[model samples]
Target: MIELKALNKLHISSFYKWLNDSESIRYSLSAFQKTNSPDEVDVWFQSVLEDTKGLNLGIFLRDSEQLIGFTGICKISRLNKSGEYFIFIGDKSQWNKGIGCEVTRLVLKIAFCEKGLNRLMLTVSEPNIGGLKAYQKAGFTPEGKLRQACFRDGAYHDKIIMSILKNEYLKSVKA
Candidate 1:
């Protein structure tokens, strides 16, 4: 679980740890080479705080404010009423515990209800079968796969485009 708060400068160390984890980095699509200097993190935090188009939520453990993962909407277009998205559970040991699903569901509530966005869209690599199922359970319908969009681990993987409209999400929630 996570609480959306103002991005802080001190959180960089934890973010860096998350980014360094291979499992987490696999989902993040960000390149990190061993370390991110404090100055760089400071700048990054400043930008995240100044982010007006979308939101980044620092995921935490409810019992402890331990930063476990991150979930957010990007490419937020108020005029277009849409956004692209990503989620990362940094600690690989936590992957199969339903925490990722819980975090995603919470964010989706913010997207469709709080933000009043008409649609939410996300992409998952073809090999990420578990992620695909989780998104499906969250009411995202597969739009199709982009062939060879991701090149990682000496292989190419398709990216699956999935989206859930406000009406669709509402219906799923009700059902």
Candidate 2:
């Protein structure tokens, strides 16, 4: 299982190491691969900690004390009770090992059980086929695709909007 722990100054070293990895930056946002010094990362981490709309979680493996990845819900709008999810695995070797699914489940648990959030949502670039499938396994469904939502690698890619309502997620979890 995975949980969202407080990311403090100490965890910054390993976390920043992950950010610098080429593989880790590949599927993330446009600024994912941008340069950042240790000081810059310190500031960024502190800023995310202060973000009011969403919780930035440091994903950890319970048994091994491994910092396998990071995941968070961002861009929240209270009127809609909606937020976007972002996740990245630090150890590329851990890919497709079911940890990502567990992390996603934990986030939904927080949203439905604690936050009383009506809807949890995310947008995955069409190129991120694996992410789209993993999200569905974790209770999200494709609402639609935004045409040419991202321009990367010299080509335009669609952004797929996916969401799970509190009722649907709760019912699925119970079943």
Candidate 3:
């Protein structure tokens, strides 16, 4: 029902809006900072376009081709064959529909099968129950927790660190 593709300039406005959405930022590190303006979003987009070590993809509805969200494997280390995973469903209406889990699997295939990465990791704020579930469902195992790693809503919260290795991914797909 959804697919991933390269993001373009046409998605700038939506990206800007999502970054500024209070609800969307509730579990995101973006709550600690500010996106400020469309120009800032454009600058960030340009950097994503030029980053050879990263892959930023737009999440779209396969039926209508609407851009609903975005996901990425960032800071890819060639030496270690690892990267940080991140995703945002900008369209609030699409939440809690198992889309996050679907997108996570798609990115895992790209990270392990295509990119030849050995490990993909992510940190989900404790309050982000949806993200935690999605990642776990997609085969990421919790490695540890970072105590008070993120501050939001006037309180510090723990972050759950999760990861899936190349071997784990291969076994999961085969099963």
Candidate 4:
């Protein structure tokens, strides 16, 4: 099983490694293009640890307590009651095992229930097939696309936008 916990010191290095991992970073909107320093990671952890509007949680295995990935919402707008969703499964070997789906569900519950946000959205790079599939399965529908929105590799790539509203998510969970 997976659990979402507060981002703590023990998980910092793993998250930093994930930031530097080329394959993982490729799909991220803010790709860690270069190797980030430990100090930089510490700064990031501190910021997320203090953010009131955002939910930055570490994804861990329940039994072994191993930190596998992280997910959260940032750019939170209390006035608008909306936020953007972001997640990464740091363990490459654990990919395609349905963990991402579970993580998505758990995050959605928090966003719509605990945070009381009206809308949650995410941007997926066009080439990120697995991440796109997981988000769709968790109830997000493609809202639109930004053509050549991001410059990655040697060329630009499209970013697909997906979202779910509070009413839509709540109704789906009731069924």
Top-lDDT candidate index: 3
Model 2: residues with Cα > 4 Å off, grouped in runs: none
Best first by lDDT, ranked: 3, 4, 2, 1
> Candidate 3: misplaced stretches above 4 Å?
29-32
Off by over 4 Å in 4: none
Please write out the lDDT profile of model 1 over residues 53-145, one tens digit for every residue. Answer: 787877777777877766789888888788877787776767798987888788788888988888889999889889999999888899998
TM-score of 4: 0.92
Model 2 weakest lDDT span, ten residues long: 29-38
lDDT assessment of candidate 2:
0.80
TM-score of each: 0.88, 0.90, 0.94, 0.92
Q: Top model by TM-score, which number? A: 3
Error of 4 at 101 (Å): 0.7
What local lDDT does model 2 show for residue 149? Answer: 81
Q: Count the backbone clashes (under 3 Å) in each candidate.
A: 0, 0, 0, 0
Ranking by TM-score: 3, 4, 2, 1
lDDT of candidate model 3 versus the reference: 0.87
Note the residue pairs that clash in candidate 2.
Answer: none
lDDT, candidate 4, 31-53, per-residue tens? 35553787776777777778886
List RMSD in Å for every model shown. Answer: 2.3, 1.8, 1.5, 1.6
